[model samples]
Target: MAVIYLVPPVSYTCPNNTTCCDDPTFDTSVFKRTIATEFHLICDKSWLQSFFQTLFQSGVMAGSLMFGIASDRYGRRPAVIVAVMLELCTGIIAAFMTGYWSFTFVRMITGAATGGIMVVTFVLLMEFIGTDKRSMFSAIFHVPFAMGHMSLPLFAYFYRDYVQFQFAISVANVIVLIYICLLPESPRWLLAMNKVNEVVTILTKVAIINKMPTDTIRQAVEQYHINYHVSSIPKGSVADLFRTSNLRRNIVVMSFTWFACSFSFFGMAQYVSYLTGDIFLNVFASGAVCFCACLVAIPMLTFMKRKKAVAICNATCGVCLLIIAFIPDGILGMVFACLGMLLNFLVFIIIYLYCTEMFPTVVRNAALGFSSMMARVGSMIAPFVVALKPHGQWCAPVLFGVLPLISAVLCLMLPETKDIRLMTTLEEGEAIGQSSRKIGTK
Candidate 1:
């Protein structure tokens, strides 16, 4: 099955002055089934392959906004359950799709659901944990994703059939949906919603499970309720992100950083086949590098200021990618390319934690969703940019390198969030940024 997708179809010459041209046919003797061969997505229809990829990202962009709003209006648990179910159904249907158009449409739906799940899950995790432990939890969060990445090739290797591979991957969502059913709703969300009893009930259970006093949990909830009323923080909308000057600046800069990160990360992943002949090895190597970086990120987040660490990692990633553009194809080139990807992975982890920390609780999901939507834009365009490699090999790498380097510089413009408490209102968020800027100027 791997051989079918990797091998190029045989070419034939047309007779001179012939009215008809030779249509290229794949050698299907070794493996008879694949999405490419099944739909004739080779040769003249090759552009459609790239278009199919873009549709998924477009759906993700749209879904991020929709689910983000839904999460804010409803609750995290409900939004997540709906997103997972959508993904599960669409993914299963996609495996059975016979037509290219139908398959593409299903993929888009899956991508949208996936986008919603990703943002909501991250926010839920952050909201559940203590601020002191968020850095550690954020670092640990990537482990499952890295494991999934590492597991994909193994699944693909064993399944051999595209439909089987799709089904295998989609079935995992069923397990997630079941697990989600048992989890508690976010207590912070309950507090924000003024459901003091629910917050106390959940916190009491948590304390009892941890062998702590339930009275302490109840008192904390009581204190939180009092503070919530005193603060009088209004519910925020998506438009709140751009309603003020400081917020608008933060959004613009952060959005670009998200774009840069996604552009470089996905660009490298997508072009691995072109970068090296050993596609399987490259994929495994990249995933391994990312896994190790996740380990490294735990300590980095624990000790370093978020802004400085992100800036340094982004700069290092850019330089390494730039070096890869000049290195000749060999073992050394592979090493440098892997190093660049590793640094980018580190930057990715830190930026996610940093962004989550920076935004006020009222608009955190909205801000994350909007940033991720910008990232989807970068991801959508990455393949097209990589496609320019046929025109000039350096074009793609140069673009990848430049984007991150620019983002690294932009990192300095944002505030440092180390040791800072999460903001509960837009005014508080703005004041924090302003104070940080004033201190930096001094």
Candidate 2:
């Protein structure tokens, strides 16, 4: 995301004496060296700015598909490790790159690795949690995501140079790399894949970690698998996603929801540059606001059905965005914009868990990956929509606002999955995702 939003080296008046920075001679003393300054992404070349953003997002989209499929085929632990390594390597490479194309190429790969980390880790986490606890852990899982956003401004403030910033962020990946030895593969995934022995060992470790009786937990799993005929459960693939009518509908609906969320979130994000305030403060405040929303979502998810919560909040977000579209950029507009972001992020948490519940274990990563891919598409198009602001100030907001309302309506087509067990088989996945019932029914 930071790669996509590099400050283009452009001429502008200084606040103190209205002194203009000439094009050829970019004052690194005042502006500092960025990709924009280093590669001269300004003036006639400024058109390439958003294009680069779109390309980086494309990298993320590709990564989501590649890693999602790879994790299912191989294992979550390996895929995640590979992505982390790639992310670390790419970040370091980009820092020293002298050519714009080379830097962009490296960043696109970095974006892809990031996309893989997000999609794979999410599925793995969901698989480890029980039905009652998924809501809590799912919401809590995203807190670090918010903190990642918060840290961007904090580090950027100290590291004014792009190279320093890259090193600062990339260095953090080394700490994550240390977790490889400690990281466990999903037990459910192992069972679903027919790796019974591996799953039992993992479960035993989990029991010890939780201070539960290990023998009791292992016996329960063994008995459950034996009684249920776990071997009959088929492995799912990308093609299997479309094998059933209901699963197809579910994927389509979920993909659209993911798309709308990414589009609106990034659309509003572009407006941050236009807001009246110190750039660092506005960005930092935006991250803080989102972090607070993550805390609020923990309770909200417990009280509301997943589908209902997403529908209600997205509609409300749309309304707020509509209001922002008609108003001038001021205190009122900023308030509504923040409100819209809060609601949008809240809906993201709901639909993410909702999508996980709607899909089967075997193809869950593939489905989530595909959905995330569509989200990248939405993000790719967002810059173009925001650029339309020159034609009509309301164009971006109006487009961004209308999408969520449609997605809210589309949410009705998805089955509610508030307290349902994770579906291990495609048959169960199809049945639960297609059928809607009263709140109390399991």
Candidate 3:
């Protein structure tokens, strides 16, 4: 949501054919500065706008790291409440803020909350379900994000008024706040926190909901002695990520993948809105194509081998970007744009699944959270990068095209893990990598 707000505003080109007061406005810039400077609401200073926009990503990265630590130490529910409250407060202020700097500050704060929510949400949802169901749920998670991404342009188009859009975003958060209140605490979090009693209670409720026998769950918990203190579950500092050779490898791969994925995803998402003709039609078409590509990837991965699926997705994305880089701005360019847009969706699902499988339970969320932060870093730079390219120039496409090729090379370094248990421990992941099996042989 924060990305949805910040990027487009910074990219806003003033309407009166004038350059931004703070920076040069490229010919292809979408948001007109005349409207921003004239209206004095949505934007004020160009550099400030860009600064606030990029700050959201940096803040989210820092905030999510803190949230991950807090969730591990305290519990998922409490950390989530902190995030929620922050959301409600910052969101309201952003909606009603009259000054540019004031609202931008609120955006940064709200971005932090958004990041925390994302890290916690994915971890909690996976914990709530059985292991076998995790992949399915993880894939399903992207649908809402895809919907939200698509919805942004639609709302921005219809509202045409900045304050109105902010109000709508705030109203949506109110719904989320109420929704979160009704959800129960994650039992896995309870177990990790050593609150055996609470874990049992939550597990029992979950068993009842699923119409499963609670006795089996209770027996398993007792057998595992979940209440056993794990003093080694130390402060999951980011540095802990490099303690082992295998973990260090996982971190490097995921970090690179995350950055590449974000660059491709947002670079195209925001750029599509700036396409030369029919802004609404172009944005809608691009978003819809990407969403469809995501849907197609789910089944392909389910039936195809994991390594093949990912490798193919990367190759497809690279090829599409390359095509887009060279295509002239006309009918053929439109076709390549649509294809490149779909590849964003494809890359998203592949990277998302791959990242989740790379780490063990001990640091799964932390690794994923940190990787997500890096991805946002890519998103932060995307708007500025696009701003540098001349209108009708293919420079941005060439650059976007190159990142995926590099990502494809990195993808080659990861071991395939299809038809295998999800890695939750450092030792377990390393063993799989060393296993005597075909890389994609199941």
Top lDDT model: 2
User: Per-residue error at 216 for model 1, in Å?
Assistant: 2.4
Candidate 2 vs candidate 3: the TM-score winner is: 2
Error of 3 at 58 (Å): 2.0
Q: Where does candidate 1 have its weakest 10-residue lDDT segment?
A: 1-10
Off by over 4 Å in 1: 1-22, 27-32, 228-231, 437-442
lDDT, residue 57, candidate 1: 85
**Tens-digit per-residue lDDT, 1-442, candidate 3:** 3344334533445556464443334332444322244333233444454565677777677767778767766777778888988988888788777776677678778888888988888777766655456556667777777677678767766564567677676667777788787777866555544556777788888789989888777677765443334323344556667877766876887788778878776777666655567666666677678668767876765776655666676677777777766766666766776787676667677666666666655666777678888888887887676665555467777777778778777777777765454443455645555663632211
Model 2 misplaced regions, further than 4 Å: 13-30, 437-442
What's the number of clashes in each of the models?
0, 0, 11
Each model's TM-score, in the order given? 0.92, 0.93, 0.85
Which window of ten consecutive residues has the lowest lDDT sum in model 2?
4-13
